[model samples]
Target: MGFATYQLDRTNIASALTGGFASAISVNQNTINLGNQLMFLGVIVLEIPSNVALQRIGPRRWISAQVFIFGVIAALQIFVRNRTGFLLTRSILGLAEAGYIPAAMYTLSTWYTKEALTKRIAVFFFGMFGGSAVSPLLGAGLLKLDGKGGLSGWQWIFLLEGIWSIVASILLISLLPERKLEAPEKTISSDEESVSKSEIWNKATSETISLRIVWKTLTNVYKWPHFLATACVFSTWSPLTTYTPSIIMALGFSRIKANALAAVGSLITLPVIVFFAWLSDTTCKRGLTVMLSIVCYLITLIVLRCLQPHVGKWSRVGLWTAVNGLAVGYHPIHNAWIQVNCKSPAERSIIVMSATAGLMAGTQIFRSDETAEFYPRGLLIMIILAICGLALVALQSCIYYVRNRSNSDSVEEV
Candidate 1:
């Protein structure tokens, strides 16, 4: 859904649309804020209904709708001028992109056995990695604005992707196989489905749960120390992803180089993610994996903040760019650890999604008051967030230590 019109580049978009004191393209903070609100609305639209609809209407139709939405979102870029239209279109993008990652993960999980799950997940997630790697090249190329038509570069970025997305939607509709009963991903044993069905019904019908299951489930996460720490650890992951371009820009690199390096960072992330995920499987320890990742992230932020001053001196700021790449695995490891350890599917589904959703608080914090300029405030917040994440795991380790000594059962240790 990032087949988007609202350009993230500061100089590019800022120069294109300016009406206020904020020199950033987000010149009108309120308008920018409103557009962001639309983006979040898009996130919610996907987060909630995507899985539910797959169960009812099926993936074939869902994928179709997804492509249709992205296509329209792409097509609409030419006409979109104000923040309202941007927000409205981004909302569509959210809904459209919502199905892809989860559905693909579920399918991979179903199709592969536990031993093979790692490879399967890697393959599925690799789609994101590969797509992200090429996205910048594609985006920049689309933005060249040199064809016979005199469209804005951003306009070409939108329109070309929209057409591609629609074609994909049709292919998905024609090719997907129908399913009589739905379970997780592509693999569902009938017996497992039968058992799962009862559990779902029981949970649904229970008064204590039904009264406010979502609220309860959300609160349930806070009650546990592991959940709390895990959430905190996960939340600080965005600095590298969201702020890296700005970080590199602060390094005083050219916008052309900065955008190009962003793609390189994504390519660098792929292996680090896979290596860490594979390591988690090998070690059978999620906490250590998370702890190590926290350290890497801490190093990344501190080094980045320190190096920002020296960037003009370095001459190789682009080379240091891979530091963000180094920390990328932290998230994939954390996520894979959660997926591997979460025993029951219901618990897995809710907790995993919540952990992911909760972590997005980082976005709010990262983007907050930075004006999408230098994220000094954002970096400070990230440093704090990273420390808290470390403390979370440390605290959990302490709790696990005491509880295990008292009960002689270490099974629950995260």
Candidate 2:
């Protein structure tokens, strides 16, 4: 629900802008894009620190607080009357949302083993993809209430979605579990049995991340490929999220219909994500599945770039749907691959947050001027980035394979 709420808030403006949002604020597409850039900037700057704070404060407390703050800020978007207000609210919202995903992922990592983590991570991301699928539909409905209570349709979208987030935060505080510090065993050791109940309670409630751990994570060379690969691939996905409705509207659909139809691709993506997760788990080949998903998306991009001009309207829609549907199919599998390679909880948290920061940085590829051309330059940039990402993934796999083989040879010699 938290993840979904974030998506809803993040994309609501994109959907609303097509209806009455731009006129309400007296802003143009460039102003909106600048606001988005500021939001991502805030997220990138605060991502690491937010995760570190999560470690010190505990997930239940810190994550819930973040969500509650996010909800408040999202709701406040309804009151923005001009460009300054829009940019300010977006930046603050990004700060509040910065670490929630990585913190939740870190919490999940503590509970699940590597072999079982991908499926669970996929399930968790259902909230995000589900929210993306639903946001436009909900926006379409709420947009009809344009004059209700004297608020614009976009205002209602922000207000109601923010309230939902606030409610989700309360539920999280009541139900989210603490970290599982140890695996289950058949019997307790005598020394463990001798520990006091007070000590056990304290251990369960408190966690501390040190500066040394942070420094180590910053300097880890092995993690850079994962971060870079995520940045490049995720950049390809940004324009779709922000422009899908407008793209569909250009096909001669009504604004509301465009919003509704934009959801088709995200709806199709849910099952595809699950299938990849299942394949990754069943085959025990994380890197292979990640690469395959990326290839699938790359194919769609190439076809869209090459054939979109000659295609009929509905055929164009189909192509766009395929592109959006396949956008993030590799994300969860890639996340699982990165998590299993990390050395500790602190390392995983840092690496995950850093990777997400890379993703935020990539969102800048799409610009206001390029939207008229259906982002030809953006599409070309995404294609280039996707190819770079594939190379990085392949190189990382080779690095790991060679390192593992060398270890095996050394053990055999010993």
Candidate 3:
């Protein structure tokens, strides 16, 4: 699903430029940005509602159904003949996918104890980053199918990507077990394991939507400065996967090469991401791990900005790789941090959704079509954001350290 989503977003630039889509819809340069706006807006609007729905429906059925529905919608992109149709399709895809990441987080929260969550969440997000890593090469190859069977290359891209999604949906629906009432054996500590089934049932059942429930969830999520900070931090990175190929192309790479080259940053970041996740989990220092990545960005972006255009391909790739490598660790670390801190199911749902919405909000900066190729403005903004993120990590780390010290002091007094 992550792969399909990235495939769709990553292909938008190429699709517009070469897939005959621009001609079909009489689209201007802003058409792609407009599509992204509508899609992200849909995601924002439907995020909370989608989580509510997820609670009512089990994760297995709700998530699988979302995959299948969006898969169909994605494949339907081949049939769109107008800008309106394109916008409508993207909007629907967003609606289908709105809560998916959060829902996955929530599902993980249910299955794993807080202490054990980072690595598992890291693995889960590996799918997302993995999808991002693979989509460009895959899309580049599929572009060759253009003009086949009365379809353009972009249409083939959408069709093939959607077909893969449909197959994945089928596998998910068939293989994923129904939501169990308790965490699987050994997933939680003995104390948590000993939680009475009735008490667990009550907690789950009590989470139904109400005005008070919504208010409480919102307030709880809002009061957590770390959550807000993390959300803002993630927004800066969220659109990178979608737009990096265009940036690479601006550096003199061809469309196919640009797309294929885009994969390398994500590919290189995979192990680094995993290792940091392990470090964060083992040391219980997620803030430090995330800060290291952000500082890497600060340095990389400064150097990248200094480098003039027409730099060698390897130089460009090397810089972009550093940027992605330093930036990609945030998702898993931040997500695990949120889930670990948030115990209530309702609270976790709202936090995840709100964080996602914040990330989407942050992506609005990338909506500039004029800057699509180089994103000078985006780079400056991200550099500033990296500094801000560094501060937030510091604040969060201080807060965590203080809280831990206070707990220890109280224990000693007792």
Candidate 4:
């Protein structure tokens, strides 16, 4: 629900609902991009600290507080009269939202084993698409209320969505469960038992931030290899989402039409994601499924980039739908792929935040104001990143293959 509100605002540019904002604040694409960068920068900077707070304070209080704070921030966006206020609110919202995904995933890990985790993550992660699926249509409808009560349509969008988030946060505070922290060491083997126990004892005894724990995670997380690979793979899709509506508009659709069409594209992806998620779980081949999803994205983007201005409208829309459809499935599969490989709660929390931060970093590369229409440069950069991501996935898969073979050999010899 928090994400839905976030997406609603994030996607407003394509809906042209931000025309009011542009006029009110004398804003431009460069200013908007700076606001976006600030938000993600907040997320990147605060992610680990926020997760540490989640560990200390507990999810029910910490997560719900964040939701409530962001809800307040969302409502306050209406009062942002200048670039400074705008950037301030964006940074606060990013900070407010920073730990949410990892927190939720951490909560999920507590309830489900690795094998059963993917579908659960999918159900939760799908909220992003659900919010995205509704945003364009919601913005389009809200845009019609531009003149009501002396407020602009964009203002209405912010006000109403903010109201929704506030209500949702209240309910979330009531409904979210608090769990007791267990020693994550219990899940690992005896070979590393001594170190795991010492770490667990320190965490349990010292509620304060442990530099040792942080350093341990920082050093060993890099050794995982898949962590950076996952970050790279995840980063490839992050920028595409923020400007989806603009991309559609660039394909010759009017602003409102672009939003409505973006809605249609999101709707198309929902079931595709659900199906691929199910396939990933049942087949027990998340790595392969994620790789295929990326391949699909690469192909769609290449086609979209190569298209002529004279291309049929439906053709462009079809490609758009296909591209987003493939994009949605990657998260659940990749997330599950990462989760199962991680041996403890600490590793999962750290890696998830790092990967997500990598994604936020990728979004900074796409500048909306750089072009009035179309994103040739951005798309080309994305294509290159996608290919790099494919290479990383292949390398990770090879590593997995080698590790599995080595493990089998050891077991057989013993």
Candidate 2 per-residue C-alpha lDDT over 1-414 given as tens digits, one digit per residue, 9 for 90 to 100: 778888888888767876778898998777777777677777767877887788778888898888889998999999999989988998898888887787887777667665556567778889888999998899888888888999988899999999988998899899887766553334455776645543443353344456897788777775677878988898777668777888888788887888898999989899989899888878988888999999999999999988888888889889999999999998888877887676565666666655555556556667778776677787888889999988888877877777778777431100
Using lDDT as the measure, name the better of candidate 1 and candidate 3: 3
Q: Residue 311, candidate 4: how far off, in angstroms?
A: 1.1
Q: Which candidate is the best by lDDT?
A: 2
How do the residues 1-414 of candidate 4 rate in per-residue lDDT, one tens digit apiece? 655655655555445432357568777666776777677777767777887898788778888887777767777787878888888888888887786777777766665555566567777767777887888888778788878999877777777877887788788779888754445564456675435544554443334335665677678632354666566656755665666666677678766677777787778778878777777767877778778878887888898879834578778777777766666557667766776666565666667666666666666656755565356787787778777777776767777777677677531100
lDDT accuracy of residue 387 in candidate 3:
80
- Worst 10-residue lDDT window for candidate 4 reads 200-209
- Show model 1 residue runs off by greater than 4 Å: 1-34, 107-119, 146-148, 174-216, 219-243, 246-254, 313-316, 355-360, 366-373, 396-414
Candidate 2, lDDT over the whole model: 0.79
What lDDT tens digits, residue by residue, belong to model 1 across residues 1-414?
A: 212211222112221221111332233544543444454455555654565565466556875666666577656656776655666765565555564445544434443443455565555556545655555656545545535396765566556666766776677678765432345243357565424543343333222212254456556542365566556655554344444544455566554456566667677877787777777768877678778877876787777666654555343354345555664466655555555544333333345454444444544655545644455666667677678777877666566566667776434435
Q: Which prediction has the highest TM-score against the true structure?
A: 2
Ranking by TM-score: 2, 3, 4, 1
Candidates 3 and 4, the one with greater lDDT: 4
Query: Per-residue error at 150 for model 1, in Å?
Result: 1.9
Candidate 3, clashing residue pairs?
Answer: 146-153
Estimated TM-score for each candidate: 0.74, 0.90, 0.85, 0.85
The TM-score of candidate 3 is 0.85
Candidate 3 residue-pair clash tally:
1
Q: What is the C-alpha RMSD of each candidate to the true structure, in Å?
A: 6.4, 3.9, 4.2, 4.8
Model with the higher TM-score, candidate 1 or 3: 3
- Which scores better on lDDT, 2 or 3? 2
Candidate 1 positional error at 228, Å: 4.6
Candidate structures ordered by lDDT, highest first: 2, 4, 3, 1
